[model samples]
Target: MSRPLKERKLLVVAVVSHAIVHICELSFPALQIMVAAEILHNPAAYQKLGFAYFVATLVFGAMALPAGFLVDRIGQRRVLILFLFGAAASMILVGTAQSYLMLVLSLGLMGGFIGLYHPAGASLLSLATRKQGAAMGIHGVGGNFGLAISPLLASGLAAWLGWRLAFAGLGLLPLFCGLWVLVDRSIKVELKAAPEDTDNLDRPDPKLFLLPLLVLFLMATLNGMCYRGFSAFLPAFFKLKIPAGTIPLVSGLVQAGSFTTLVLIAGMVSQFLGGKLADRFVKEKVFTAIFLLCAPFLFLLSRLEGIALLLSATAFAFLYFANQPVSNALLPNYVPRLMRGRLYGWFFFANFGAGSVMSWIAGTVAEKFSLAIIFEILAAIAALTGILGFLLVRVSRPDKKPEV
Candidate 1:
């Protein structure tokens, strides 16, 4: 049967919104260190830049529950519009800042605004698609593209027009997008989910959801650790693996190449198909199992040298991000609407809060335990997470539904 045009259009808007918002947000990261260097006048500006971003993300994660409430109360449209304009203003603030504190404050505000995006967007996307799992994958890919292209585009534009100009000009993106969505007919938030008591999987029995939430929380923590370690170190790793002369371009290209193409595609496929496969196969842990299979692939990639490093890095990037789509895909299915934002907030808190610590942890681990140990830790964590994810899937099974 042919899918209706509206479904395609809704997904396309979701993708476009995801792409633009992320692209605009990420574009600043590459320039952050440079901006800090110029204004802060410190050689350690790079690390501080990372810290600023990390703190902002932590704040964003912290506020997810409230953001979700705002979304539900105000409706996704207005909250989204606020996020868009707020983000743009923050970017402009970032561009015009003359001091370090101002920069930090600007980024902090930007992070807070960006915080409103996922749950609202997730809820919107969830409503738009008949299939949650598939929609999540597509949603995640939009984020991945933002992450992948942000550094590249930001770097290129900043170089051409200066960092300040890049921020000032790119800031206009969300402003324009915000105004458009304010009146866009396509986004019809037709149904507000009725509050229902449920556990982590959003099924009935509020108490039981704790165990699954715990497992998923741990899973999120592990994912955060892997994410922080990899994002923080990949460029350094690439520099070590590749020739010093080629370090600049190769570092960015290696990460971008794999995810820009493969991860996004894999995300949509895994979510949509994983859900259907789970439904048909009646395999409760179907989506979770796919993430489990990705672990060895990530660990194996970290062990290579030279060209092997490049190929392996690419493989791992795709594999690691492949999990993002699946994680959220599992949420709405098991998590009831009322708890969706709260649990999702918990998910981000675990991920980002743990991620906040990972930077310091990795540095310490490298100083004492060795960087290689970090990957080993991630491998073990991913394996454990896969098991928990599978179990969580089982725990979330609806009562009347068949359980495998």
Candidate 2:
């Protein structure tokens, strides 16, 4: 049976708040880089800041595969409650650090903590929602909220208390939420397990699993690259191009606005619409086609200036994030359930791992070139992902069960 309205609402609140913590954290990198440059008395000090994310993901990628398997085995609620604190702490440590080594170590530690969130969170959300796109939509929206708000909150707080405070503040959010989830464990959630075909459990089909994994990896790589460019460069871009404090506030607010709106629209609301359409329509092709089309809007938005740029950015983010719920919602249905967590973990790992590389490359580009070139290159990558996403249906197929 589906959860009661009140119960579902509570869960959404928790997940959404969980997402806000990430948003708060993600925004810290650029500001920290800037601050490190100013105080460390060296532009190169910022390299360690980005290195923190790279090193953390390297450690994290090693763990994520196992993490997913463990989620299914141990239960999502327990892991999230236990490990999210590490993530929260990484932020605090990063915030408090007085030296480059401290900053690097703290950031790496932070990535280690972040590594634990998705497997636990995504699996739990999938388990909670059954096969409902609406539920995932709401959950996706929560993540987007985190992504959106992080920049604004970090930049604003960084302006006052220093960027470290943003990290410290965000680091603590998960702890409180983890506590709440712990207290609420007495309540139970029931979901229909993905039906098993025992005969094929070990060796039913190799191709089915490989395809979705491959496609998702590719998509994530492109999107991750694009995301790094946008999130890392946009504020600085805005600051250089726009008026005083305009970049921080406007970039943050616009991002926040786009995130919340897309979640409500594409993530939550449009998700149900996509689901209904998928029931009768040619779902894969249609969805992929729609995704491919987002590039034009993004390209158009990338070229503008001032308020026009902000408005364009809002529209661009909306369209970009809009694809998330639809794409993620499609995965469970295609995969065999038992493999879902593994697949999701690998999916995120591939995305983030590749993305980390992209971010490093982007930073290199920024060092050598300019932020404008970086965004332009990312825009091109987005277009490439869109094209690849559409072709995915022809190249790959989902599994029969949706367990993991």
Candidate 3:
């Protein structure tokens, strides 16, 4: 039977909400250049700001387990609403900050709220749809679009108005979205038990789960490190590479932001395509191929300059983000529906929490060695992730049913 209209509406709203969260979450990276110039005022001071960003990211990662636990106790809808409202308020607070300490505090608060999005949002989407790969792909498109637009929007607003107004304005989106979700009675929020409530469901075989879980965690951590490290410095890297006279239509700031936006746009297409591929093929195989392909692009990014640099970065981003939906889809195959929230939380803890540390490392490397080295390291990480993906393919048997 066809899905109900209400179910489709829930998917749209959930996707849109996920997009808003990404916009808020990614705004800082896009605005970092302007923030460095206007607020910090020292080239080296960006590393200090990077430290602050790291702290916020650490919180974003650290809170996932707790957020998952809360989702299990309360419900996905309630947790999602809290994430939207709380994240919006935190963005507004970030805009109003005047000092470095205030900015750090505001960002940390925003990270905490942003932390609630992945586990709850992913769980909600998983429960709402059976086409896990396609659903994750559609959901990922929302997030990728947000990632694509945030830089452009932040830069334009910063150029026309100011960075503060940019942050404050973006805050309104999630706030309004949260209110809409609150009153929408059609979206289901209660948790349901597994279909098979047998003893085997209650106590799953450790051998079936343990090895695959470790592989997933390792791959997630590596992917997170590469993603966070590369993104944290992409704006700065482009700013240094792009000549001041290349784009006269706007200021250098806007040009840099535009480049970042262009690179991320490739992710939108790749996410959708990757999701479709996951459904048609073995998800582990698709995941492994994407990671393997990404390494060469990272190496190319390290060597290229100007237009070549932009093209290479775009290719790299396409491969890097394509894995998102594949991994999200693969999770349900191994995990039971009822425990998905907490499992997703743990996965994100590796992805975001451990991965967030890359920002600090990238910053340090940029300060001491060179930004190019960071990409080289990322290339190695991507290759390693591919190896882990292959291992996952061997360990995760397709014939097994999900255990509670």
Highest-TM-score candidate: 3
Candidate 3 wrong stretches, greater than 4 Å: 189-204, 399-404
lDDT of 2 by residue, 138-170 (tens): 666677667656655666666567666766776
The stretch of ten residues in a row with the least summed lDDT in candidate 3 is: 193-202
Model 2 root-mean-square deviation: 4.7
Question: Every model's Cα RMSD, please?
Answer: 4.6, 4.7, 2.9
What's the ranking of the predictions by TM-score, best on top? 3, 2, 1
Q: What is the lDDT for 231 in model 1? A: 58
TM-score of every model versus the real structure:
0.79, 0.82, 0.94
**What TM-score number comes out for model 3?**
0.94
**lDDT agreement with native, every candidate:** 0.62, 0.59, 0.82
For candidate 2, the 10 contiguous residues with the lowest summed lDDT are: 193-202
Model 3: colliding residue pairs: none
Alpha-carbon runs more than 4 Å astray in model 1: 1-6, 40-47, 192-210, 244-284, 300-305, 363-377, 390-404
Worst 10 residues of 1 by lDDT: 192-201
lDDT by residue for model 3 over 61-100, one digit each (tens)?
A: 8888898888778888888889989988999999988878
Question: Top lDDT: which candidate number?
Answer: 3
Clash count in backbone of candidate 3 = 0
lDDT of 2 at 71: 73
